[model samples]
Target: MTSRIDLTDKAKELIQELTDKHGPLMFYQAGGCCEGTQPQCFEKGGFYPRMNDAMIGLVEGYEFWIDRDLFEYWQFSHFTLDVLDGFGPGGFSLETPLGKTFKIHYRLFSEDELKDLEPVTRY
Candidate 1:
């Protein structure tokens, strides 16, 4: 099945590095003013998902989640997780101290891929 989210090689490497240092990790993507729009990387359970947040998929065994309203706005697209070399938008994400930032690049899902997309888990 097609995944709702995928990570680039750079992102995978960074995640592995972060995981090695932090033990386990998770991602939360929320859309709003401040740091909400930029995906935040946290140790597992470090950031709690709201009641309707969507568990989109996993990256290197780490759960990737998005705010319910943000997921609604992005439901028709597929997400690509990537890393940038400089500081990220907000200083709250785990990568901020490493002089790196997590970013999301998205594209609308194709007709066929949308039909058999991996299901999203909500809490």
Candidate 2:
């Protein structure tokens, strides 16, 4: 419902690549070490739970969805999504809606990592 997450060109490219290989992309927020939520992106899966308030968007043909709660959190703050390519091969940095920044590297989820994820639809 909000346009708080600004996707960078690099981010778009990455999402496109994933979508090309898979189908749709899934992005969500989960519990993390900090006060803010941790952003997680994955390939589309079947039987994703329905969230009436999720924010959905398309980035270079890849569809992305953010939980309503996360969307609201970003909307009310100053969070921005930026692609960082200088930190030893770099990755993504989420400038918290509150002005705090968190960096995440690009890596495929292992079988173990996938266990905790819930399915999100593909567009």
Candidate 3:
């Protein structure tokens, strides 16, 4: 089945490095205040998912989840897990000390692709 989210090569490599140090990891993107909008990398199960949050897909063998409210706004798009060079404010992600930040790059799915898009599961 097609995935709703994917990781860049650099993101994969960074995840590998992070996993080596932090063991398994998970990702979350929320729509709350503070660092909510930015994607965050955490040790597996470090962050709890709200009951209605959505599991978009997996990347690098890890789950990628998004807040329910945010998912509604982005449901029509596909997301790529990407990294940026600088640290974002209040970034509590694993990559913060490494001067990197996790981010999302998205594009709207085509009509055809949308019809066969992978399904999302709720937490």
TM-score to native of every candidate shown: 0.97, 0.46, 0.96
Model 1 agreement with the true structure over 43-62: per-residue lDDT tens digits: 89899999999999999989
> Which wins on lDDT, candidate 1 or candidate 3?
1
Pairs clashing in candidate 3? none
TM-score of 2: 0.46
Rank order (by lDDT, best first): 1, 3, 2
Task: Look at candidate 2 and tell me the lDDT of residue 56.
Answer: 40
lDDT string for model 2 (1-117, tens) is: 233344666666656555566676665543333433545455555324245445444445444455565544443332344444333111232222223332333334455544543
Strongest candidate by lDDT: 1
Off by over 4 Å in 1: none
Which model scores highest in TM-score?
1
Model 2 scores worst on lDDT over the 10 consecutive residues at: 88-97
What are the per-residue Cα lDDT tens digits for candidate 3 across 1-123?
Answer: 567998898899899999999999999998979996899999998999999999999989899999999999999999999988999766689999999998899999988888898999999
Q: What is the C-alpha lDDT of each candidate?
A: 0.93, 0.44, 0.91
